[model samples]
Target: MLQRLAFILLAGMLGLAALLVLGIGFDRLSKVRQLDRLPITQLNALNDGIYATSGRVASDAGSLTAPYSQDSVVFVRYLLEEEYTNSKGERKVRTLDSGSSATDFSLVDGTGRAVVSLGLQISQVDWQIRQTHRQQNGSRIYTEHSLRAGDLVEILAHFDRSRQRFELPDRVAGLNAIVSHSSLKIEGGKSLLIAGLWISCATGLLAVGLAALLVGLGIHRYWVFVLVMTLGLMAVLWTIGLVQLKKDWQIAADLYGRRSAAVAAAPANPAALADLYAYYLMIERSASQWPDSLLFRMAAPYSFRVPTLPQDAQNRVRNRLAEVQSSRFAEQNWVLFVVAACWLLTGLLIHFALRAIRFKRLVEFIPTSKTTGLAYGISELFGMIEVDDRYPPLLSSVNQQKCVAYQYRIEEKRGSGKKARWVTLDEGGASTVFWLKDALGRVAVNPAGAKLIFPEKKVSHEGKIRRTESWLPPFRSIYCLGMAGIADAEASRLSLQNSADFGMLITTQTEQEVVRGQGALGFLLTGLALATSLLAGTVWLAGAGSLTPLDLLQVSLLVPLTLALITSILHYNGLVFLKNRVDKTRADIATLLQRRHDLWPQLLVTVQTFLAHEQDLQTALRAVRDGQTGASGQPQNIAGQLAHERQVMARLEAYPTLKGNELVQTFVAQMTRNEDELALIRTGYNNAVELYNNQIEQLPDLILAKSFGFSAAPMWQG
Candidate 1:
């Protein structure tokens, strides 16, 4: 049986790997769907931040010579590959070199041309030149992908005013900065197909492996591994959940305490009453994370309405907020707690099961439509939210960001240390008409009387008070199900409004995510419900003398196994957190690199204006700024520009008059701050890398490290 378990373990690992691949495929599919929704922006009238646009390829600094093809082109990428026979007599190919020309290029649209950087992910290369030849080592293949003067390509990135070029957008930092000739729709379709293939092939293998593993296990020990693993995972999840619940409780208590004090201090003040309402909404939001037990929600506010300020500010259930001191979650009744736990699990089972079925049915049967193709009836939309610029935007209380619709909330805290409890203070929000936009077009969407489904509530804490906010921020992609009607009959324009049957449903989740989450949650809850019942029955039977001590004690080995597994899990989690910290540091470096964008360009212009008389020096700087190289061969990229700035600053300091210039002095001061920021990023990044590397290389952790393939990150010498 043990040997069989070992074999099953190998198969299970393979299945898990296959599942991981499948998950990646689904993720890619989701990303492709989202990418397809972005409307193309005109190059001339570009957005201030990230935008996608298509244009013809051109170059200001003439064409670059393709190393392999020897053809002159505006921009080019080449891949050198060598074919070889593997140990298993299978044909394999390895890339010898994958390099691209390092030069600034131009993307010309109908309106205008924008400067583009070469370090972009060439997703759909034209591959103008392809050659194969027999070499001394092996059969060599050389492919050159060229972007000539007339070739149209799509670029989705932010315009860097400092370097005067476009790099990859920070939002999609996880993906390659894709530059494709194909339309976003076409590209997305291809990506979806590839993802389907990945899921199909992987799923097939996983199914077969699991079948064989199950057969090998036979009758007696059939579900032993599955049972043990499930139980272990459940324990871990429960532990995490308990900790989270405690945190939520503390947050709620903090808000309630403050709200009570505020109400007492200024009971007649309408401002204080509004503040009280905001606190209730936030308290409700926090408590929503807890189980839907009647007792748990006894102290938590049901809901709040922050109507036109000072207009008889009222709450739906005033009792929930008014008597907020007593919380059922704080009570330690063992019997009541047990009963609540069972009831909670049962409720979750029913809720998730129904949701899984209902959501699946609705999505599959209701039919989805683009904003461009809206009819005068039901419409299911997957697009981005666009705030109607005509109206003043609402502000989120926590982040304080501008939004189309928002719920601003604040909770007041009172009491000392562990005895603290929070009360509702104030809550306010706006949900007016907005636009639902897709790649094709945009349509009006009235959020009034709509069922808004926002996932995360932005939360923050300040001395004696807590604030939580939820909002439909501008350009937030969403999946909406609502009734459509002809708003402008003459124009034949449709608008999303409340339906008599379906009402209006808007969520900040993609359709695929919604389906997956619903299905996964339902399945897990069902299993948990069954597991709970089984355990309860077993305990009952044991107490009733239906089972002997030996029968009950048969699984004694689980004790040490559970302990060892728990310890390993803790270590593994620590390592993962460390790795994430390292990743954050790397991301922070990229963010810090852009901090001096506005300053750098201004500084450059100021310095050049200061030295108006030095024609030779001016000419030299222009040449350096362009494609021309100086004595140090000044780099043209942002990093290289920083180095060049250092040299120029030194030259400026050498001249007393130039150094004293007011504009130069201001820029210099700002540049010093920028340098300090860069210094901190460098320090943080390298330190995180060092710590992660050490953790992965250390004793007990290294076992999991190697298993996870945690290779050491390169140290930054900067």
Candidate 2:
């Protein structure tokens, strides 16, 4: 249920993001279309209204060197960055340079020029360079990025013809005008084709929304069908948008070409413009001299101008386009951010999907096998529990249920309502090597790391905040899967041989519910992987090269096919890690089995020896009753089988080595100690399993278990 909620939330966010991008695309496209219809005017035509024009920066005023590169620039801004180490030993970089700019330059057209006044706001300019230097103690300083001189500029400003200060002849004076509005806004290059971009973004948004709706409506099983259909429609829309963009570019180019040609052919004779220049000055002076008349007020803001050469107009248009392109390149933050988000989501989905796949394989490949005839490698084993009599049996602290091994935990609720949480007060569990007997034979199991999915017996107390105790009881038929190998042993040992590199360890409890969970995770992960991969591809292609969002859809249209290949490689690596863990765990289990195998024979021998001694002592007692008492000393307490037997023999040194009932009690005690030692050895094997399982389950270390495939072993119970 949590997963479903998370998924739905993510989908909603993505949809909203796409919608936002689409809207932005449409807005930009609208601006571009407006620019196309806007009438282009020459600088010589003075008027009192907003006007768009392009020109080159003039070095009429003194220049300052760009902070980083020290390049001469008429107007520029830059940032200085300094690097330092913080208290946490992390390196950080911060801007140290304050913003600076110069506006003491002039803008000139082929026919006339305007002296740009000081204190007027300039448009946003990205003219800066970056540099870095190391201090003696290894500190570093740098700049980010910068712009320099010779850059073309396109601007929209207010023009006023009444504020002219220069005294030129009537003809030239009429052409002179004042331009105001300090804040200059850099034009975007793609602004011309913005309408086409808008259409593309809107179409893309619709495609995604449609796909999402279909999937939400239960068409998810045939996701490829939805993807193919949407992609096809999107492709058509994109083609149309691109075609429109191409046409606009061609139109602008043609206009520039014609203007250039016209300028080249026009005669440069001053007499051709003499009549118009005289007429413009007479009208301008008359407009200012006379007021309150309809014609005077109507023509008051108009300034006549001589026609400039077509070549010069072409140059200005070309410069304007160049400036637009530069600005567009700089304004790519939105596109880059969207692309990054796509990659991040894709990566997350792929990561979880791969983990699910690994776990699924584990559930399928590991078959539950019988304890008898179990192979010497990692294998699943299940059987009835048998406890060795020598070692103490485990008793649950909560209910005091007897078992070979058990674990219990105590938890209490700490907070109330939504903030409530279960906090553990104290917890611990212990295990010993227990017998798992089937029809054929028995196998020892160590249940340390296994996710013990058993019928947990819980006891709850309605106290301050509800305390609960849960436990994994013993004696019931349980299953386990982990590393199985031979353990170290003496030469005379039979070596039941289980684990090697590490000891017996349980990774997970074998239960039916866990198997079902594995299957569910597998299916979910597979679906997520496919969906995320497609999303990444679509985002990459749709947002490529500054493409904007359609009304409701947004993404790049360019894709790198190698992303799929990389994902495959990552999955392979994950599989390799799992395989390695399985192999190691198998070796560890085998080592314990080997030692147990060797100890079994030695234990049998000790039991046989004890029986033989008992028989000999009985015979000696019979002799003593028959009036054949030996001249041996008093009997001593027996600490060990061999020692007690020798003591009995020494007492009868005058007679044969066979003694009487003098050491009978000692013999029984020796036998008991021997049996206990044997049980302890088996317990040692169980402990090893517990330790190995624990190491894998530790946080951070648990990452290995989750990724590399280390399953916990079930404890052996007698």
| lDDT (Cα, tens digit) per residue for candidate 1, span 5-48 | 76478568856775676466545544442343234656654423
How far is 306's C-alpha from truth in model 1 (Å)?
84
Candidate 2 local Cα displacement, residue 260, angstroms: 21
Whole-model lDDT values for every prediction:
0.55, 0.44
> Which one wins on TM-score?
2
For residues 285-395, write the lDDT of model 2, one tens digit per residue.
322321212333543343223344455554544454443321132345655675577567756755665555445445444556565445434456666667777434677
Once fitted onto the true fold, the runs of candidate 2 whose alpha carbons sit more than 4 angstroms away are 1-311, 326-353, 366-373, 381-424, 430-444, 453-468, 473-480, 486-563, 574-718
Off by over 4 Å in 1: 1-348, 376-378, 389-392, 395-400, 449-462, 485-493, 499-503, 536-718
TM-score of each: 0.29, 0.38
